[model samples]
Target: MPGKHVRFSRNTHFQSPPTPALSFSSISPASSYAPLTPPVIPNNYLPGPSPYTIGYAPIPKAPTIRVHPVLEYSSHQNVDFDILNHPSSITKNRRLLSSLVLSEPATSTPLRSMVITCPHLPWIITVYPQSGSHITVYDVFYEIYRSLHKSITSSDFASLPSDSARRASTRAYEQRYSRHRSSRHRDEEKRSGMLRIDFLMGMTRFAGLSPTGRGPDVWQLNIR
Candidate 1:
């Protein structure tokens, strides 16, 4: 009976079993995964037109130019005669001087004296008693026309030794003939036939006149 009492003692507490270690080797190679989905865009949304598009851009317009009408004259003689009766007193004096220089005998002592006494003609004239009696007004005019042609079209400034002299001569020539070249001057000259002769002395200054009336010549008035 004692032996049976000693063997009857028992435990009341319960114990859990040990857990297995986790590793990649434990995972299945043929395991199924869900496929990735893309984000959704609105159907109404659209991109703007690119600046690089050629036909889509507007073309620029060309600039408009305004041109003035050129004035026309009847004849060259009408134009030439107009300078004599110009409204401008200065122009009249200059034209008168030119006329006198061209028309009058270059060797006439009295004419030379008159030109000398007149404050306008600065060039000194040594009248050699030789008369331009044979040279008529028509001849002088013809010579003038020839000189004008040479002055206008001829590029012969080779006679002038210095550049400064050439330039000065060129400028003087331009100033003298500028009126003849202009359409307005031509029109005015043509209309000035009825105007009175009011020759104002010392009203204008003539440039490029040689002091001795010898050299540095542009147009030769070969009336002598």
Candidate 2:
């Protein structure tokens, strides 16, 4: 311990042994030299955009509404349109309308339902036979009308199956109803509007008040 020594001098640098005293390999300039470099990436910059196109996936448009061929299939007697098709009159079955002249077929099943709404109007009709019960027979009329109304209000008649006879029938039914519906709305407004005025006057009378005079006892016209 007395002979052991260490030195620090401004003029001389301390050197490591040629290789670490514990290892056999010789030290070389390549092994000893290292540069104090900063890290590979700094925090400020963001990653660049990807090579793949930056955009929304092109939205595929919905396929154009397709209308199928207006097909007339005399439904099997026992199924689908059975109860609705068969009514009490055997002679009045579709054979009557089927026998009518200047008739043609339509392209769609729904369109076929449009034909036979009016008795007076010219039509190439296909009849829906009715059930035996009185209640059901009456209901057939209502159901037919409801079906027609729904068909008219629904999207487009272009999709209806094409049949010359069927189309003509549908046209007649639609034409008759168009006139009827227009007049019906006009009549309703006339009736309801007058009834509303009558109701207001009745209320005023019951309350023992007149609209012309003022006060809590007098009726006030609340024109909304």
Candidate 3:
């Protein structure tokens, strides 16, 4: 047993290798570096033309509509939109509304006066150029309107007074007449005794005596 071959154990004769220490000064920041990027526009964003021109613009050279009410309800004047003096007739977004009357000439004579029985109701009058073709309701009304326009724009044009003015004038005239009548009646009362002297005398002659003793005469004839 003493002569057995001696075997050297590796662990008993070996030493542990030394480990390197970590140092904070030798650390590098290569992993922390980042690139900057521009902001992203949303997908739903929409662009448009100038928003200033989206509003309404005034129409050029449009005739000023002057609505003069001659009836009780001028707003009710309704006519087909097709029956106007359209020089360069183009359909427009805006329309004119009014209650007016255009005068029509009588069948036998040119009477351009609007003959209305009741001026209190609403009505409209439109003017149209003369047409060589057959007459329609529109034609008639248009012709009437032309006549009225001509008459209105002429030097001899005179509109009738309104109801209020007419009523006031009539009342004044009646009052004056009443005052005249009352004065005339008072004068008649004053002259009544003088006018009856002659008639009484004539009657007294037959009845035997007159209270004033005067003869009957034309100036003193008893009218009452």
Compose the digit string of candidate 2's lDDT tens values, residues 1-224: 15422111122122211111110111122223245585687779767978887555554542221111111112222112211122222122244222111022211111212222221112222323232211111222223322322222112323334445334434333333333357876443333211111111122111111122222111221211
Candidate 3, poorest ten consecutive residues by summed lDDT: 215-224
Give one digit per residue, the lDDT tens place, for model 3 in 127-154: 2223322222223333322322221111
Which of 2 and 3 is the better model by TM-score? 2
Q: Please list the Cα RMSD from the true structure of every candidate, rounded to 1 decimal place.
A: 55.1, 45.4, 57.8
lDDT of residue 65 for candidate 2: 16
- The CA lDDT of each predicted structure is 0.27, 0.25, 0.24
Estimate TM-scores for all models.
Answer: 0.22, 0.18, 0.17
Q: How good is model 1 by TM-score? A: 0.22
**lDDT of the structure predicted as candidate 1:** 0.27
Q: What alpha-carbon RMSD in Å does predicted model 2 have with respect to the real structure?
A: 45.4
Candidate of highest lDDT: 1
**Residues 1-224 of candidate 1: C-alpha lDDT, one tens digit per residue:** 22211111122122212212211111112334355485676888766777785553444432221110010112222113322222122232335323333333322111212111122222222222123323322232332222222211122343344666444544443343344777787554333321111111112222211122322112221110
**By summed lDDT, which 10 consecutive residues of candidate 2 come out lowest?**
201-210
Clash pairs (backbone) in predicted model 1: 82-189
